[model samples]
Target: MNNHSMTRRLLIGLMTSITLIWLIATVMGLSVMEEEYDETFDSSLQETAERLVPLVVDDLFRKEEIVAPQQLQAARPDEEGEYLTYQVRDKTGKVLIHSHDAPPTPFPAPLQGGFWSDDTHRYYTATGVSNTIFVQVADAFANRREALSETGLALFLPIFALLPLGLALSWVITRRALAPVDDLGLEIEAKDSGNMELLKTDALPLELLPIAGSVNVLLQRLRNALEAEREFTANSAHELRTPIAGALAQTQLLINELGQGPGKRRAGQIETSLVKLNHLAEKLLQLSRAQAGVGVSEKPVDLIPVLRVLIDEFHHSGQDEDRLICRCAPNARLHGHYNADAFAIALRNLIENALIHGDPDAPVEVSLKADGSISVVNGGPVYTPDELAKLTGRFQRGHTTATGSGLGLSIATRFLEQMHATLTLASPASGRDDGFEAVVRFPHQD
Candidate 1:
C-alpha cells in the first residue's frame, strides 16, 4: 500500500543488519589474515636467509672472489620467485655478494638488527659475528598486496553470491507470515448487520486467535444492542404517535367548541403544544430510520417537483410566502439516484430551517444551480466560521427560544449522506451583510 508497510520495513531492517554483519566480519577477518600471512611467509624468508649465511661465510674464509651460490640465484629468469631479493654488505654499507634480482647498492635504509619496511620492500636484516657483515632479505610491496587481495576475494565471494537469495527469501517469508491478517480482514469486511457470525479462528496462528475472539464478541454485543433499540424505537414511536394525534384532534375540536373566554385561550395553547410534540415525535422517528439505514431506494428520483411542493406549504403556514424564492436554470432537469422519500425529507427540512431562522422581511432564496447543486439562502444572524462548521450537529439550534426541534439540519445532513451528497453551511451568503446559506452539492456526474 505504501513504502512504509511493516513487511517492507522488516525486510529493509533485516538486510541492513546482515550487510553490517558481513562488513564487520570481513574487516576483522582481513586484519587477522594479514597478520597470520605476514608471520608465516616472513618465517620462510628468514629460513632462506639463515641457510645462505653459512655458505657466504665459508666463501669469505676461503679468500675467494664473490660468486653467486647455486641456491641463491633465481630458479628461472622470469617467474614469481624473483619478488624475493637478498644482499650482503660490509659495515660501511658497501654491497658485496647479492641475489640476481638484488640492487647493486645497499637497501634504502641503513641496516637495522631485525625486520623493517620502507615504501617498496619489507626487509629482514641479520648482523654477522664481528658486526662487519650485514645480510638483508626483502620482499616486494606489490607481491604482498596481490596475495592479500586474493585471500579477501576468496573469503567474501560467498556472501556476495548469497545476497539476492536472502532478499527474495525474506520477501516470501514475510508475506506468508502476514497472510493470516489478510484473511481476517477479508472475513470481517464481508460481515454486515444481517451477517454477524463469529469469525473462524481455527486455522489462524496463535497470535491472531485472541484478536479474532475479541472482535467476534464485540460484533455480537453490537448486534444484540441494535436489535433491542430497533424493536423499542419502532414500538414506542407508534404507541406515542396514536395518542398524540388523538389528543391534538380532540384539542382542535375543543378549541372550536369553547369559543371566546379563558377556557378557549387555554385550549388553543394546549393544541399548539400537542402539535409541537407530534412534530418532535415524527422527527425522532425519521432520525432513527435514517441512522439505521432503512428506506434506501435503488430507483432514480426527480428533485425539483418535491422542492416545489415544500415551498407551497410555506404559504399554508400563514407566513409571508413571497419571501421564499425558487430559481432553476431554464432547460435543465435535475435527477439523482436516490430514494424520492429521502430527497423530500432533506429538502423539506432545509426549507423549514430557512423560514424559521431567517429575517421575516428579507427574501429566502432557494435556487438550483447549473452545476446540479441546490442552495437555500435566508436572512439570518451573522455567524462566525466556527459556528457554521457545527450547524449540522444534532439538537444544535441557532437560538434556544426558536420553536424548533433543532434536528432539521442534522436529519437533512444524514439523508444527504445516504445519497452521496453533502450539506455545507456558510454565513453571509455571497455579497450579503448578514444571512446564512445551506448548500447541498450533488455528486459529480450523477
Candidate 2:
C-alpha cells in the first residue's frame, strides 16, 4: 500500500552522493593541508634555531665571566608576545642565555640537532662552537593546531552553501528528466473500455517506445474482442425475437384450441417459457449496449419527457395508476451531458424491479429531488447490507419468488457508470421500517 515517487528517490540519491563526495573531498583536503602546515612550521623552527646559534655563541664568548646565565631582552620589549621561544644552553645542561619569553629552566630536548616534541611544544636544537653552545627554538602545539583548524573551516564552509544549491538544481533536473515517464503513466491510466485508442509513440523517448508499442497491441486485441462480443450478442437477440414471438403465438393458439384439459395446461407452460426466454434475450441485448458505453453524449438533454413516457407505458401495461406514485420537485433538474435513451433504460429497470418485487398491496413511490437525483422507494422486506451488495450482479435475484431475468440492476449500473453517475441501493427506505430504496445520483448538473 505504500507508494514512492521515482523523482523524489532520484533526487535524494543524487544529493546524498554529492554531499558524501564533498565531505570526503573536504576531509582529504584537510589532511593534506595539515601535513603542509607542519612541514612549513618545522622548517621555519629549524631555520630560526640554526641562524641564532652563531649569534648566541658570539655574545657569550665576549662576556667577561660567563658564570651567571643571562636573559636576552627583545628589541621591542613592550610588544605583545612571541610565538617562538628559544634558550641557549651550555654543555652541562645549563641555560646560559634565554630569550625574553623562554622559560628559565633548560628545555627537555637532548643537546643534539634536528627536532623533538613533547605534549606542549615542538623543539628544534642547533649547536655551534663544537656543539658546546646549543640553540633550541620551541613552537607551541596550540599555534599549529589553530592554523589547521582555520584551514579545515575554510574547506568545510563551502559545502554547506553548495549543498542546498546542489539539491535544488538536482530536483529541477530530475523532474525534467522524468517528465516523459509521468506523461506516459497518465496516458496509460486514462485507458478504459470506452476509450481504447492506440498510444502515441512518435514523441516518446526511445526507452519508452517499446512500452507504448506493447500497450497499443494490447488495446487493439481488446478492441477486437469487445467488437466481436457486441456483434454476437446483438445479432443473437435480434435473430431470436421473431421466432420466440411466433412460438408464443402458436402456443397461445394451441391453449385456446384445447379447452380446459391437460394439453391446454401444458401449452400454457410452453407460452410462459417462451416469454421468459424472450425477456432474457432482450436483457442480453441491453447489457451488450451498456457495455459498449452508449450512455455518453456531447450535449445535455431534457429527460423529463422520457420519464413520463416510461411511466405512462408501465401504466398502460396493466399496472394500476394509483399504485405508482410519481412526484417531481419544481427545482429538480438534470442538465448533465448524457444519452436520454440510456437514462430511460436505467430508470425503467429501477421502476420495474420495484413494482415486481414489492408487496402487491403497498404502492411504489418515485420522486425527483431538487438536486437532480432520482429515488424509487417501494415497500418490501428489509435486506442486509451484504445481500443488497450482490443485487447489482448479473443474474442475481433477491429473496423473493418474483419472475425476473435478474439483470435489471446490473444493466442499469453499467449504463449509469458510462454516464458518470452512481446507483445506490438501501433497504429500510429513508423514512420506513421495512422497504427498499434505489437512488440515482449524477455527478454534475447544468
Candidate 3:
C-alpha cells in the first residue's frame, strides 16, 4: 500500500532531485574552493622562497662557516608552522643551512629552479647571489589537504542541517497540491446508479480536467440510456393495460350470456386467463419501477404511521382488516432513513404473502422493533430448505395452490437490497410445523 501511493512517489522524487542537485553543487563548490586555496598557498610558497634568496646570499656567498641549524630563526618544529620546511644549497648541490625539521638533502633536482614537486611536497626554488646559492621552500601536501578538509566541513555543515527541512517542506507541498484529487476519488465512490447527476470537472486543476470531463461524459450517456429503458417499460405497460382490461371485461360479459354450457365454461377460462395477464402486466410495471427508481427522503420515516396507513388501505381495498395485526415496540419510535417508497413495497409484499397463503382463521402477525426490525409471521405452509433457497427468484412460488404473479417476494427482495436492507424467509418461525415468516432488517447508521 505504501509503495502504491502517488503522493509518496511524488515526495520521494522531489526530495531525491533536491539531494542530487545539492550533491552535484557541493562537489563543484568543493573542487573550486580546493583550486583557489591551492593557488593562494602556492603563491605564498613562492614569496617565502623569494624572501629567502637575499638572506641565503648574504650568509652563504661569504667565506663563512655554515650557520648552525638552530640559528635559522624559523618557528620551532613542534609548532603548527612546521608545515614549512626550507633547505639552502650551494652550486654543487650541497646542503648548507636548513630548518631543524628539514632533511639534509636538496629539496628538488639539483640546479632545478622555480617550482617543482616530488611524491609528497610542493617546492619552490630561488637562486641567490649570482645564482651560486639557492634557497628552496617546501610544504607537505597532506598539510594542505588537512586545511582544505576543515574548510569543506565548514561549508557542508549547513547543507546537512537544511536537508531535512527541505524534505519536510516538499512533503507538505505535495500533499496539499494533490488533496483535490483525493477528494474527487471519494466523491466518485459515493455515487450510485440512483444518482444521474454528472460529475463536475470545472473546479479541478487543469491537468486533471480532461479525465474528469471524460468520466462525466460517460456518466451522462449512462443516465440517458437508463432513462430511455425506464420510459419504454412504463409506456409498454400503460399501452397493454387498456386492451387487456377490455378483453377481460368482454370475456366476463360473454360468460354471463352463455351460461350453463361448454361455451360459458370456455369463456370463464378465457376470463381467468385475461385476469392473470392483467395481473402480470401490473406486476411487471411494479418490478420495472422498483428496479429503475430509488427514494431518498430528508426526514426519517416513522414506521408506526407508515404501517397504520398500509393497514387502513388494505382494509379499504376489501382485505380483512381483523386478519392483520401490527405491534410496535412500547414507548419507542421506529424511525428509518431508508427510501420510504421502497420500504412500503417490501412491507406490503410481506403482508400480502402472509394473508394470501396463511390459514384464513389465523391472524397474521406484524411486528416493529425499536431497533428498526420488521417481521411478518403467518400460519402458512412450512418450506423445505431447497424451496427457501429458490424462493426469491422470479415466478417462483412457495405454494402451488396460491394464485399470485410470484414476483412479489423477488421485487421486495430487490428493493430491500437497494436500501441496504435484507428479507429472509423462515419456515415455521415458532419452530412448529405450520408457519412461515418474512423478516426485514434495515441497515443501521451511527
Q: Which candidate is the best by lDDT?
A: 2
TM-score of 2: 0.88
lDDT of 1: 0.80
Give all TM-scores, in the order shown: 0.72, 0.88, 0.74
Give lDDT tens digits, candidate 1, residues 37-112: 7887688677776676777777677765654332346457566467678888778887777887887767885766
Mark the regions of model 1 whose C-alpha exceeds 4 Å error after superposition.
1-12, 43-64, 67-82, 88-95, 99-136, 140-209, 299-320, 331-336
TM-score of 3: 0.74
Best by TM-score: 2
Clash count, candidate 3: 0
Whose TM-score is higher: candidate 1's or candidate 2's? Answer: 2
Residue-wise C-alpha lDDT for candidate 3, range 1-446, written one tens digit per residue = 33488988888888788778877887798899889988988999999989988877776556456643323655665675677788888778878888867877566655667788888989888887678777888989998899888978877777689878987888888888998899888877766566667777768898888878887888888888878877887788888999999999888888778869889888888988888888778877877877675644667776667777887888788776888888887754556666777777778888888898777788998988777778899986778889987989988887757678898898888888777788888997866678888888877633
Each candidate: RMSD to true structure? 6.4, 3.1, 5.3
lDDT of 2 by residue, 255-297 (tens): 8889888888889899999999999988988988887888978
